[model samples]
Target: MTTNKSQDSLQQQLASLPQDVQPGRDLWQGIELAITQQPSATDKAKPKSWVYGAVAASILVPAVAVWISISSLSGPVEPGLDSAALIAQLSEQYESQKSSLLVTYQDKPALTDNWQSQLTELEDAAAAIKSALKHDPNNVALLRMLQTVYQQQIDLIERVHAPKWQQI
Candidate 1:
């Protein structure tokens, strides 16, 4: 009797169970649906990426500004012309204008009058170039040319006006 009862229970359990041992299509579909609905790690990292972007911008802005400042301060440099050449060119122009400059002046009683003013302008320009030469002693060609121009200007002025009252 016991053996028959045991067999009957086993048969009832087997009838209640599903035929397939593996999961159904609905179970696999539910698992895939749940995984697809979850949030990704990249979405959480967006704010961190923005922070890194800010850091990069902060560093780049100052570097660009410093580069521009340096470039502007130096200005453009010509390959052939140095500071000495610039001084010589200015001195040449000064000498070329000396005759016309003196003629424009009229005889006046005050020492500060006509000729004096023109001389003063030439003197100032020469002084500035001389000062620049002191800082750059290597440009011998420019230095020699400027000295010659300055000496010539002085000699011409002395030769032209010998009598003090004739100039007056």
Candidate 2:
């Protein structure tokens, strides 16, 4: 009879507790939204790829333009040697030859002042031969005559001036 009384008291305590303690929502609907609302993997890379492509094109276009402009500005043809260059070369040759002849004359001061005229004529002849030689570098007769004229003028100046350098 005591066991029966204890069992009754336990049942009465359980019946007195509250029954509305659990929270509620639609779990299936939440799972469907999470799975269906995400963007596709293929859609994520398009804008970044286009941005990189546009930047590369922008850099390449200006680089090609600059290269073309510089190429055009420099032009495509080689410049030819003009008459001034030839004349300057002849003048240089004449000066060098005359300087050598003048030194030779100065070394032997016994030469006549009249030899100056002959020296001038030899210089003129050398200039003429140089002009001709520019057109034909292999003209043997012209070169021989040019050398002969040069030597003749030198010999004449040496005869009129002091003895030859070896003799001195």
Query: In lDDT terms, which candidate is top?
Result: 2
Would you list the C-alpha lDDT of every candidate in the order shown? 0.56, 0.58
Collision count for each candidate, in order: 0, 3
lDDT of 2 at 39: 80
RMSD of every prediction: 28.5, 35.5
Q: Which ten residues in a row have the lowest lDDT in candidate 2?
A: 69-78
Position 34, candidate 2: lDDT? 87
lDDT of 1: 0.56
Model 2 compared with the native: what TM-score? 0.35
Tens-digit lDDT string for candidate 2 (18-97): 87765487588888998888787767744666766774674355345434433432343234524344345434443454
TM-score of each: 0.27, 0.35
In model 2, where do residues sit more than 4 Å from their true spots?
Answer: 1-111, 163-168
Tens-place lDDT per residue, model 1, 1-168, is 999999999999999999879755558777888888866876764566676677457535544543443343254554554655545554554455455335533242334336555656667766865886768734554455455546556544543443345532
